[model samples]
Target: MKTFSMSPAAGERYVPVSCPVCGESRTREGWNCGSYRFARCIGCGHLYQNPQPHFDGLRARYGDDYFSYELENDANFFDLMLKGLQDAGFFELERKLGDRRRFLDIGCATGMLLAYLKNRDWRVQGVEICEPAARYGVEKRKVPIAVGTLDEAAFQDAAFSFVHFSHVIEHVPDPRAFLLEVNRVLEPGGYVITVTPNRAGLQARVFRERWRSSIADHLNLFSRRSLVRLLSECGFSPIGWKTWGGIAKGMAPNFVKAPLDRLAKLAGFGDVVLVVSQKISRKPQDPPVGPPDGAP
Candidate 1:
């Protein structure tokens, strides 16, 4: 549960950015963390870090410290991922996929999830930004992992039947582009599961600027509505949505946390959300349509 500080390096370039989802420049000032500021997009209710660090600088944050953090928490993270997928009824979908079970994990740290899936008869591939983490997964875990960005990997078209990324899209410099790359690599009718913190959840409303996910490393903070919109725009149709993490560990007593967790799952509001979607067909060269409403 250690959050990355991601302190900006000296002379690192920072630039203002429009909302990645709705493509709007108008935003309301949001939480002010120590070194970074968030902005709520007026067009689509998307929260993102504005005047963000350059992509290269941001990518450089995942080094030795990040590797250690992922290594320490890999098992816990893998368990959570399994629970999330199970809650989303992913096993049924996996069965439906039959022998066409080519899977890809983006930003896969140490490849624990991929390893597990591989053992379950999946042909798995992984992309990791941190070199050490990728090396460890490849050498120790005996999993196939490429050390670089997804775009840099240049995978073949329609390469996978299942694509997964947990808590990774929020760190992307351009989520739309990242997703398009996903779309390009995903086979028709393939499934994609995205997991990220929910800015509109109860914890965020209560904690405001003090929310655990309001960290410098998270460039985008997505709500359910914003995320659905983004997924639709990126050629995915959401089939199921699941959320968990009502109260963070140690934040409240077990009695209080237990009920809150139940309520979070029942009411569709939680600290984190997992969206399961299927890729829809779209012309590769077609431009992304604008937001639904014309208010912009």
Candidate 2:
């Protein structure tokens, strides 16, 4: 993905926020990309943009320019998402998931992944915030895409068996609320696969503020621990995870990049991470207790 330029508009408001995962207010500056800055939470080691641009301004960024970018990179994104899902054993899981093959892809730009799975006998739907991209998916790709946020889609409870979102949660200003909405719509014991840039990866550490992913579009950057913790708290139990992309293109020679990529996957410190989790079934009278304090 290319770096996005998102300087704040004149007189635009930037709201400060606490850590979404742990509700921690203590944070230290992490990095800055253009006019945007990231802060690292002292409580859970979470990284997010503080003094975030107003929601309306943030929403405005996903117009025609963003649509063009998505259109240009749809094929590459599809391949990467497919590989990530395969690495997380989604293909085998799908075969054993009985007849309830419903799938929902959030932030499904152009609905490429939805169309691909729809061809594989899965009932597919998509939620995309970009109007032009959603229209393209619906009209050109023949995929059913709702042009709105998942919460705005207002799906029925237990609507889908599988939920997937790639490079999406980081853009959300309220990721906890987003995950709760995801949990509400997903059937009990259903699966959720999340792909996002890892803040605790080699690229972020090496490139620091210059990292491509530390761009203006991303509001939150999750590491493996922080993301898994957030998922568990949001009513899901992590089953598996995979990470890749140790060195980005043009960053290193092929010989070096190849080994680093393999090593990143094996060592669990890639630039991006894909986590697969199952929705924990909650009885109507179940306690409101949270996940274990230190369970791995």
Candidate 3:
């Protein structure tokens, strides 16, 4: 594994939070990529950053230039096609719902997905952690974006019919708690769609920690098995899921963009994973009624 130095200023501070999945205390490990501080949970083998940077800090790290870079140089055409693929997932969700329904997108960076769904007449709302990106989405794209973390947002429970969180779960401090919140906001039988980098993929094995997905922002590293387990524990029943190599993964590094980069598909090393799950309403367990009288 390639090792990187830790910045003295960045490495000096971090707050401790219990493991999101196992509820275990996390101990500091070291600095990763000279940018992110790392902590590992001995109970669940889940790694995270202690006292991770806030949303504002993350926004500073990924400025407006980053989106432009993605739009202009980094796999631009391929990403558009990937959007179509993501829409296909949304379409499947529509079929499952049997009606036009509201959709909530977490980490909706530039509102591309929200815009796409809006065009299809689905009620679209988004929660974004990056203030600049959220502002840009509202000002430039006219998207209905809420700027902040989901926990801080004032959305009512059981409001949304569908929710999508693409590549955002790994960045969360508490995956279990986050999913519980997702369940609370989603109506019974509402679908949750997620796409993440597959830690069990061949590229992960070949590249190990050097895999591009293992960047500074990524805290939790989850294999497909682990992700499935986590979701099950969080009260979601798996609808369908799959693993496939994405074209952009291969063409992203080279400025030479393609409609669909075939290197990973051809070599079979691309590391994209898809999961679809549904929220099941748990039967309300009533609290025992206290004795009417003052009898002890």
Candidate 4:
């Protein structure tokens, strides 16, 4: 895995750090790729790249070719994403929320999903960290995009009812603080869904450093236990979870690969995992005790 320290992309901005979730200084060697090494936090079992790029440095690494590459290659990317959303029970959240129309997609690159939803009449807002990416969404796609990180987006309290971001949590430097910001903007019982790589899955176990997730930019990695623990700590209630992907065993026909993939997920050995959680209502104050049934 090419790293910020070795590559010119990140420049002289890399620094060593402790685990963001557990604040643990002790770590076990998890994997090494190129010039970087990943460590598993002894306190929480979270995996992270020990010396990662500074925020500005990481931001500077993304270039204009980011979205256009997908435009040229994965033309049906959004369609596939919509299908994945349905599979992940996003529509169920829509049904449950009923009248709550606002949706926020963090790290919404090119605002494709937001633009798609906006066409369907949902009040959509997006936040993208990359300026070029965010500007494309705003200027080209005509979507409402705020160009910044989640904590810097400055959304109002309880501003949205549904929040979605795929494959972004792992890149965050501090996931607990990131989720806290996510929780702050979501209304009570609002739906939140995220997809990230599963370290406990077969892909990581088999390929080790060769897994797509073993990269310099992916700062944090989580298993089911660590993911739920972090979410619960940040006040998100569990809704649903499932492991998927990890079809890297071989190039077989879908007829063969599909069942094996399903079995892999069912047995908790998939590469990617989907988690649906919600921001629950804060604990209420003690119910008002009336004084003698109408004392002025």
Estimate every model's Cα lDDT from 0 to 1.
0.87, 0.86, 0.65, 0.76
lDDT of 4: 0.76
* Model 3 whole-model lDDT (C-alpha atoms): 0.65
Tell me the deviation in Å of residue 57 in model 3: 4.0
lDDT of 1 by residue, 1-296 (tens): 54665677787888899999879999887778877888877876678898878988988889998899899999888888899989999899999999999999999999998899999999999999999999999999999999999999999999999999999999998999999899999999999999999877888878877889888889998877678778888889889898887889999999999999999988987989999999988643333545532111
Q: lDDT tens digits, residues 201-255, model 2? A: 8897788788878888788888877788889888898899988989898989999
Across 78-159, the per-residue lDDT of candidate 3 in tens digits comes to 3743563564475666876766489999988777778877887789899987677788778877889998788889789988
CA error at residue 222 for candidate 2, angstroms: 0.4
Per-model TM-score versus the true fold: 0.94, 0.93, 0.75, 0.87
Which residue pairs overlap in candidate 4's backbone?
none
Report each candidate's C-alpha RMSD, comma-separated, in the order given: 3.0, 3.5, 9.9, 9.4
Q: What TM-score would candidate 2 get against the native?
A: 0.93
Tens digits of per-residue lDDT, candidate 4, 1-296, equal 11121143634477788887667888887777777768777776667888777777676656655555544433355765686788888777787777778999998888899988887778999988767778878998999999878888899999999999877898888887899888889999888888888877877777677777787768887776667777777878877888876466455788877897889778877777778988878742232222211100
Q: Order the candidates by TM-score, highest first — what do you get?
A: 1, 2, 4, 3
Among all windows of 10 consecutive residues in model 3, the one with the lowest summed lDDT is 287-296
Q: Pick the TM-score winner.
A: 1
> lDDT for model 2, on a 0 to 1 scale?
0.86
> Which whole-number lDDT from 0 to 100 does residue 24 have in model 3?
72
Name the candidate that leads on lDDT: 1
Considering TM-score, which of the candidate structures 1 and 2 is the better prediction for this target? 1
Q: Deviation in angstroms for 70 in model 4?
A: 3.9
